[model samples]
Target: RVVGAAKDLPPEGKNYSKRYDSGEDVDRVLELNAGTVERDNINIGDNVVVENL
Candidate 1:
């Protein structure tokens, strides 16, 4: 699990209409492209960390 702050998010609007006011929770999962896994023996359960900028 992870906790952080954002300058924009959904439920406020499809676009960032309430970005200037405050942000909200945005929890979701992302799928990695098949080509990104360049390992021969990649496991099914692997831990990955991604940073958004």
Candidate 2:
């Protein structure tokens, strides 16, 4: 989950935008917040390509 702009994330999820504003390391923050199983699907530091519809 990605939290920010009215989006929802898990309890441990830090506000993505807030993190950005604070210049926190995003991938590391995400990894830290994710559960063990979630980490399997989403590897921090991996390249992610987004497609706009």
Candidate 3:
């Protein structure tokens, strides 16, 4: 997988979903590349909890 460069993630806020016609997908979360994650010492299958500050 391609490693994503260190970039600012989209801010967390209300997200509008056209498919569901709702904001259900508004967690405002994005996934980093596998390599990027691994570089941060997070291995695959590891349980992780991320909270917005």
Native RMSD of candidate 3 (Å) = 9.3
lDDT of 3 by residue, 7-46 (tens): 4445446884423222333433446654666477755345
- Residue runs of model 2 more than 4 Å from their true location after superposition: 1-40
Strongest candidate by TM-score: 3
Give the residue spans of candidate 3 off by over 4 A. 1-30, 33-35
Q: Write the per-residue lDDT of candidate 1 for residues 11-51, one digit (tens) a residue.
A: 54556554231143545544344445444333435545679
How far in Å is the alpha carbon of 23 misplaced in model 2?
A: 7.0
Ordering by lDDT: 3, 1, 2
**Once model 1 is optimally superposed onto the true structure by TM-score, how far is the C-alpha of residue 33 displaced, in angstroms?**
3.5
Maximum-lDDT candidate: 3
Error of 2 at 12 (Å): 13
Tens-digit lDDT track of model 2 for 1-53: 33312124445466554433323333433233336435455443445444672
Give all candidates' CA lDDT scores: 0.41, 0.38, 0.46
Can you give the TM-score per candidate against the true fold? 0.28, 0.27, 0.30
Model 3's lDDT to the true fold? 0.46
